[model samples]
Target: MIVNLTTLDQDQAIEQISQLEPQLFGTSAWSPNAIRQELNAPARTYWADIDPTTTPGNPVIRGYAGIWFDGYDTQIMTIGVAPQHQHHGIGQTLLQQIIDQATADHAERILLEVRVDNTPALTLYTKNGFTRIGLRKRYYQPEGIDAYTMALPLNPHTIGFQPTHA
Candidate 1:
């Protein structure tokens, strides 16, 4: 249940992102306007995870994931699942879709950062072959939380590892 976030789907995407801010960042980290600005940015490529069979205006944007691919390895800008939709494989599905899109777009790798304390998200990323590569101190604002940087190298010829965290 994944699709590209085209211009026509701007408003819907904004609404969904706004709804996730409170629970995700524990604050109004992303407002509709802020989301629109980023989603509509000329330099970024956005994507949405809607029910694969749904139509426009009726799209079930339970989770939103986006990347900023500047014609190179994509940077996963943001990813969030609806509070009620968390831990139901929605995050994994969204990440896979983004990975597929990155592959289709000819990206050699995909990079992202997750809050160091976000175990569920870290698990999802680790299970998708993304490895911890670095750290971003105080990556999240407000109270200044840090994040772990991760990247997934894409190559069918190479063995992909999906580590299961205990």
Candidate 2:
């Protein structure tokens, strides 16, 4: 099920993020403090994918994503699905939420950067109509990985795109 990240979910989300950080972001995972600060930021909105079937105190978070919007544009700050929960449309659900949020905020466009080597993420973004607009050299620090800058225009008459299905 989809839900906004609440104060009650903070500790659990942080724990899940910590476990996936090394695998998802390699050496560039955001620190726990950094994640907390981002979640508390005024202009940021984050959401979590949870299993509604779980018991009260043991809620399972399958994935999480965040975006930063400033009225004009929205940038996807982070997105990840637990390894075991991947390939189950969770990532697409999280991404669609951000797209909808950007549309609601009247953003002109949505932007994000992904490592050039992450084929799965690249495929997901491309399928959602985000086009490669530019590149940032060595964007991922410590590892010296380059990134592709992508954007999805949010024209008023065409605020969102249809999700492609195979």
Candidate 3:
């Protein structure tokens, strides 16, 4: 199930995303401090996909995503699914939620940067109507991997795209 993540969920989200970072992002993984700051940052929204069967008051986060909307454009900050949960449509669900949030906020567009070699992420973005806008060389630190900046225009009347409601 997908749920909005608040400061109350910070520690669990951090631990789960931290464990998945090495497998999902290599050296570009976000630090725990970074996650903490983002969770508390203004105009930022985060969501977590938790196992529905998990115990009450204790969730097992299968994946998590975040975005920042500054009253105009919405920028996807991060999206990661555990290796064990990959290919189960959790990423797609998270992306759709972000898109819905952006649209609801009347955002002009949504923007994100994906590592050049992350095929799965690229496919997910493109399939969701995000177009390649530019490239950032050496965007991922330490590993020095290139990144493709992508965007999705959100004017429904112009793009013929509609955000889904679950």
Candidate 4:
């Protein structure tokens, strides 16, 4: 139930991690300050999926995602759905938002690293056209889990790029 996807503001940023950190990232959860910095970064885009049908003063954040754009390339910084809300296409909606933002910013491709053992994440990325391009040994900290690097090439034409006559 994707109602309106909104940029995560300062107040919401704190709430985001507080509510979903333990459930989504476990021990590797990012600090609220870090999230604030990311939200304020010039080259980053972050969005929160809100379900408007929820009760007043208690908005439910279905999911959230962020991306970093650097001219011709984009990297997915993070994407997650609350444990209770998983497998409901909210993740896909969040992913598409980042892809759209990257495309609008003229990114030629998107890249991300996912824990190798996370089958659901791998499945979602693969379904969305991301392919395994490389691997990072022990990329995840503390637990020392390996990671798979994936990339998705974007079509310039589909991103609304128009060539100008010289």
| Residues forming the 10-long window of minimal summed lDDT in candidate 4 | 1-10
Q: Point out the higher-scoring one by TM-score: 1 or 3.
A: 3
Better-scoring candidate (lDDT), 1 or 3: 3
For 53-141, candidate 2 gives per-residue lDDT tens digits of 88887778888899999888899999998888899999999999999999999899999999999999999999999999999999999
Local error of candidate 4 at residue 72 (angstroms): 1.2
Residue 71 accuracy (lDDT) in model 1: 75
- Tens digit per residue, CA lDDT, model 1, 3-83: 677844667667777877787878527877888888878667666667666776778777878788777788898888888
Could you tell which candidate, 3 or 4, scores higher by lDDT?
A: 3
TM-score-wise, the better of 1 and 2 is 2
Give me the runs in candidate 4 sitting further than 4 Å from their true place: 1-9, 55-58, 155-166
| Residues 1-166 of candidate 4: C-alpha lDDT, one tens digit per residue | 4433343345764676567876887776777777777777887777777776877556677787888888878999989898988988889988888788877887889999999999999999999999999999999887888999999999533557678899
The TM-scores of all predictions, comma-separated, are 0.82, 0.89, 0.90, 0.84
CA lDDT, every model vs. true structure: 0.80, 0.89, 0.89, 0.80
Residue 67: error of model 3 in Å? 0.3
C-alpha RMSD between model 2 and the true structure: 6.6
RMSD list, candidates in order: 7.2, 6.6, 5.8, 4.5
Cα lDDT over the full model 4? 0.80
